[model samples]
Target: MTYRLPSLNSLRAFEAAARHLSFKTAASELGVTAGAVSQQVKKLEGSLGVTLFRRLPNGLLLTPQGEAYLPPVTKVFEDLTEATEAIAPAINSRKFRVGMSRTVKQMLPANWPDHDVGLRNHIRDRIET
Candidate 1:
């Protein structure tokens, strides 16, 4: 069956804006300008033919429709993140195997890479040659 849905970009804009209740904050999270987020949300509302947020002086308030829409949209984003991570092992582990010659290893400290906390997490294993 064919399903008619709004664009993913618009949905993401709406979801982020609704959650933060501020287009600026949402834009920061989305790595876009505030105007871009606002435009995308406007596009979403246009497609849905419903107003999701009420603009206020301080911030935003979710309309009743927005309150209802948020849960499923958030769930979709969560599910999508999980799905993508599952398919991409590098994204999940994001670690690498370290290989070094014996001379190079001897040049460094005994702990070597492990001495660095941030580096240790990314190094899954060390192989000496």
Candidate 2:
């Protein structure tokens, strides 16, 4: 069976709001307006067909469903960020040596010198593989 997911942006907004329990706080953290954050959260709630938050006079409160859902969502986002950073070139700047056969090394230019060769090669290798 295939499961459908909602928009990532909506999920992010909901996660932020759930963590803070305030639409205004979530908006501030996300750098968007409170209305936008509320709209995103609303969209997420609608997509999930569950009431995730209870609007209160003071602020917002997480419903039982939201409380139950928050940890997994937070973990998923954290894991995604960690995974992306793990493979990100900007994060992994250490030198990586590739042991190629003589024939493969011969295919590369011997005396070619470029200031951006490492960056270009890294990008090319990422795209190819």
Candidate 3:
């Protein structure tokens, strides 16, 4: 059945942006650009006819509606993640996985884990995207 609701992408953008109170942080976590996050949040606000944030020159502050909305949205995402993991145990296994962004990786020393050969012994594989 078709449902009338905001797009999932917009909802995800709002949830991440509101949680961090920064489009840039949300974008980093979501693997998108800060501008994309801002646009999605803006489009969501327009569709909902609600002002969700007060954009200050320094940072963001949630409007009363946004404060009210964040909890349920966060809960839904948590539940979705939990359910997905439950059905796909390998995805949530005990295997050690390192997920890092280029910006974050650059913050570390150039030789990082490589400098410590012992670290590589435990890692069966390394994948970069």
Candidate 4:
């Protein structure tokens, strides 16, 4: 079945902010800036046409809509985690090997010009000595 949804990032931001009840705390947990989390939550709210939180002087309070929205969104993420974990080993173990043509390898320079010498000069000098 197809699911019409807001952006994953927006959803993630909303979920984190809801759990923490503070955009700054959520931002810290998500490794982003507080403004980024707030913007994402705003984007999610716009897409849903609902205000998810009441912004207060000190912190945030969840609106009724946000209270209703959180559980299902959290469930979706949990399901996603379970599915990814089930497939993780195969995903992790798969190797991507790249082959370059001899001509392409030859075309690439191994070292910069003489004026850019540092460790390269030391190595070359040692080799020459």
Candidate 5:
């Protein structure tokens, strides 16, 4: 089944801003500039058709709709964190095995070029393209 959802970044901005009631604080926590957080929250508000925060000179205040919205959004993020943590150990324990063709293996370099700048440049050029 398909479901409509706003952008994850917007939801994250909304949640962070609502929690701290300050765009600057949310921006710090999210590793972005205050303007970026503000823009993200604005985008979220536009998508939801509601003003999520009442902007103030000093700080911010969540509107009634934002207050109601905060709990579910926060819960979803917490649940996602828990789910990731739960699966991390099993994920870490898994091993990957690569099988290559004999011809491809034969073509592989035996050792990295230690003193050959020309060979190094040639390999670098091939990888970059």
Candidate 6:
């Protein structure tokens, strides 16, 4: 059977909402309006054809479907983050120095011979030694 994935933004919203059990709090965390969070969650529900939350006067409650779905969703994000972090360059590595040098070259004036030569020599020295 084929399964269609919901929008990433919507899934993010739902994940945050599920974590907090509050759409308003989720919106605050996501830097969007509460209405936006609600809309995204609604869209996600529509896509999944499942009622994930039970809206109440005080706050939201997770449905059985939501309760069951939360762990896997959380795990997927956690796994993705762990995988990305595992493959990422070390913080103390020299990769960032080269990247910064490249950025400086891109932003500096092309006709300034002295500045350009000095910067190039500095970067080459760093790379060589």
| Alpha-carbon lDDT of model 5 | 0.85
| lDDT for position 21 in model 4 | 97
**Span of 10 residues, lowest total lDDT, candidate 2:** 120-129
Number of the candidate with higher TM-score, 4 or 6: 4
Regions more than 4 Å wrong, model 4: 89-129
Per-residue C-alpha lDDT of model 3 across residues 1-129, encoded as one tens digit per residue? 988889999999999999999999999999999999999999999999999999999778999999999999899899999998989967754566889999999998777777778875666677867
For candidate 1, the lDDT comes to 0.91
Which stretch of 10 consecutive residues in model 6 shows the poorest summed lDDT? 91-100
Give me the displacement of residue 82 in model 6, in angstroms: 0.7
Q: What digit string (tens of lDDT, one per residue) describes model 6 on residues 47-101? A: 8999999999989999999999999999989898778778984532433254345
Off by over 4 Å in 2: 1-3, 89-129
Instruction: Name the lDDT value of residue 88 in candidate 3.
Output: 90
Q: Positional deviation of 68 in candidate 2, in angstroms?
A: 0.8
Q: How many Å off is the CA of 116 in candidate 4?
A: 46
Alpha-carbon deviation at 75 in model 4, angstroms? 0.7
In Å, residue 42's CA in model 5 sits off its true spot by: 0.4
Provide backbone clash counts, one per model.
0, 0, 0, 0, 0, 0
Better model by TM-score: candidate 4 vs candidate 5: 5
> What's model 6's overall lDDT?
0.84
lDDT of 2 by residue, 15-64 (tens): 99988889999999999999999999899999989999999999999999
After TM-score superposition, the amount by which residue 39's alpha carbon in candidate 2 deviates from its true location, in angstroms, is: 0.5
| Stretch of 10 with least lDDT, candidate 5 | 120-129
Residues 20-93 of candidate 5 have per-residue lDDT tens digits of 99999999999999999999999999999999999999899989999999999999999998898798856544
Model 4: per-residue Cα lDDT over 1-129, one tens digit each = 998979999999999999999999999999999999999999999999999999999999999999999999999998997899798856544443345676775675764224355634433222210
The residue ranges of model 6 lying beyond 4 angstroms of the native Cα positions read 1-3, 89-129
